[model samples]
Target: MAAKQVKSRQRVADHGEVFTAEREVKAMCDLVKQETERIDSRFLEPACGDGNFLVEILTRKLAIVKKKYKRSAYDWERNSLLALGSMYGVDILLDNAKACRDRLYEIWEQEYKAVCKKECNDDTRAAARFILERNIVCGNALTLFCVDNEQQDTTEPIVFSEWTFPFNDARIQRKDYTFAELINAEEPKRPKKEGAQQTLFDLYPEAKPEPDEEGIFLQQYITHYRRLSENG
Candidate 1:
């Protein structure tokens, strides 16, 4: 059977929003068979519509995680979180973005519960949810700016968190960067002065360094896991 469609006809017309069928999603993903199977390999869906592509990618990664780490709960949890961290998405519609985040969380939560059972804790689940919120965002991929749900303005640049585990520790480290800077990192050129000659690369935004405190703040924000680890 074809995959269920998520958006209305008007939405499809207005935003050109159409979810890909499961079969096609799998077929296209299979073309990059090696990357999809590698747990830490990153995948970004520029026009992800309710995460049709991301959901499948996460599922594939989790399957690998399960096979390799099933016996070790710690390994399973850590690797699963890593898999979640690697899948990113951006959607124009707010509803689609929220739905995609929830869908991805549900996929992760189910597997986590299956493996961890009574050992599954809320802090771990919260960490997974937090990762999803940052990874899958509501934004205009073309403009590289996030859409404000209340004002429907594209004024804010979409910032994504990069999660890392230093020295195989349980602590999660996060660094944030604007989508514009990330996508244009290699090609950005400074804008010409009033009388200077123009260049093609000048059209791109110049990359800026992320604030040092941003990581500290993110670490503090997701304190549930921190506190739980301390207590344990």
Candidate 2:
């Protein structure tokens, strides 16, 4: 059974679906680096089956910092680790989660070796492990519970947290927001404007409207705007 399981995972890896290759990973990292201007950008991989995206992100971020500051390689390396916090991930499978964390630490170890110009000790490896264990949590990405349908309330936005585009409208007091909260907020009515308007309730109207229909509808609008902002 163990062997068969290994083979199955290998097949998945070969299909270029689960464990990503170094080159493709590098490409993804490059795209993120180019598009984002956040000094320490945060990235989240919703279905992070094995942390491939997060590892790749760390590699690119580390390289960027190293190029900018060559002299203080140690400090740069620490900064790179700190930057990993910005790179979030979520995986349902426990084994996959562990593997993902191990791969990230391995990448960190390799980077540390290259930066320090010397072999990394157990202490350094332990430090990397510590961070990985703390950050990589096992939980359902869509485990939000609606405490009050009308009001804006959620356990917390996890891996799938989204942001929306900017609004030139001065009427919108809160320009930015999240999809979940927006769908749950009290939008009495559609803003007196015309443009792209998509709602979760529209997608799943039968899913059961919250007690306070207005609050939840308006909340949905806020969430929609927030998601657009993030993508924009």
Candidate 3:
């Protein structure tokens, strides 16, 4: 008999914990296949801790690609390795990030070796290695900013000023948006009822000041009453 599935587990899967189960992995692959008509696909795991999702995605995508093409086993392996670019990930921990990259590379290497029926070359290995390292960046995904929060510079380099290059150029600098600031700005702007309502008497028929009061004290009294009435 199969073991019982654990219930009441923690909310999110961390670095050590395996996030995607065997069944879930298959389900995800099915979803991907159904949604995308194209053989080539792209998948990204924003918080990929140890690359559980990426590994499954790579495995399934490769299998599908190989079956569809019906090429030789060598082609199958080459295409499988090439599928690494379809997957991307990000993790904060350096060690975990490195381990995740290594794990993905190992999967690629194993498939490549089987297809070649001989040792893999430096170029093939290097391609896999580069994809793993560069694609799986070491950074906090939560801190990641979208397009709107990008930096702007009126002061341009004297040379590039003539040509209209994008102010928020990726080459210029890597920009980061504050999650906190965005959240704060999104909060509802409360109406200024208190301050605005203070002058509400100005709209009333009796609101106009009386010039009929001739004496200084009477004028002051009238002014005070007007102020008090308006405020109240």
Candidate 4:
């Protein structure tokens, strides 16, 4: 049977909670086949209801991770985290947000335990959960703000984390930007002294990143991949 698309009439009335069918979800995902298969391409669903769309995207990313990195548990673990980190979701319903996070973790954990069995560690698992927690949000996408249990808007604006292994090392870096900032992001026009071309690092040095827009960040954190749970 097809997966149930509607949870209940009450939910539909309250939040318009109708989930996309698996068949339609897959067909839509196929339209972006190459990006879906790219291990680190980022995807965000403004209204992810229990992650039907995000789950399918993650599944595709994990399959690519497994195919390329399965031989070595180390490679598998790191790439899997990268795949998981790249997905993002937001839902107005708090229950839906929480459920989405759990659903994502369960899927990641099942694949993780199957592939990395003896080599798996709690820290890595926790890191995966942390990524889901940060990536999935209980918020009003329309208002660009977070929401409380009663489905009312909260004072806090919606913020999303950008994760990357900045260096070719085990450490991961996270920088937070408001949903508005990202949506409004544009290339900064540069000034030239007539004959000069400049390297990117000249403007954005390694020690300091010069964002095009001021106040684009809320906070930043860095930690070893396995130890990411400790920081955020």
Q: Which one wins on lDDT?
A: 4
Model 4 spans with C-alpha error above 4 angstroms: 185-208, 212-215
Model 1 ranges off by over 4 Å = 185-232
Model 1 over residues 1-232: C-alpha lDDT tens digits?
A: 7667745788877888778888899999999989999998999999888899999999999999999998888888888998999999998888889989999999999999888788888878877887888899888887777778652546566777676664366655455567766765432222323434222223223312235543221111122233322221
Cα displacement (angstroms), candidate 3, residue 87, comes to 0.8
List model 3 lDDT by residue over 18-62, tens digit each: 345667756766776653333346566776767777877776665
Q: For model 4, how does the per-residue alpha-carbon lDDT over 1-232 read when each residue is reduced to its tens digit?
A: 8879998999999889999999999999999999999999999999999999889999999999989988888888888999999999999998899999998898899999889889989999999999999999999988778899898988777878888888767777777778876787442222322324222343335624556354656566667789888774
Clashes of 2: 22
User: What TM-score would you give candidate 1 relative to the actual structure?
Assistant: 0.79
Report the alpha-carbon TM-score of model 4 versus the true structure.
Answer: 0.88
> What local distance difference test score does each model get?
0.74, 0.49, 0.46, 0.84
Off by over 4 Å in 3: 1-18, 35-39, 68-78, 145-232
lDDT of 4: 0.84
lDDT of model number 1: 0.74
**Which model is ahead, 1 or 2, in terms of TM-score?**
1
For candidate 2, write residues 45-99 as lDDT tens digits: 7557678778767777777766765567545544554555455565655666688
Candidate with better lDDT, 2 vs 3: 2
RMSD of 1: 10.0
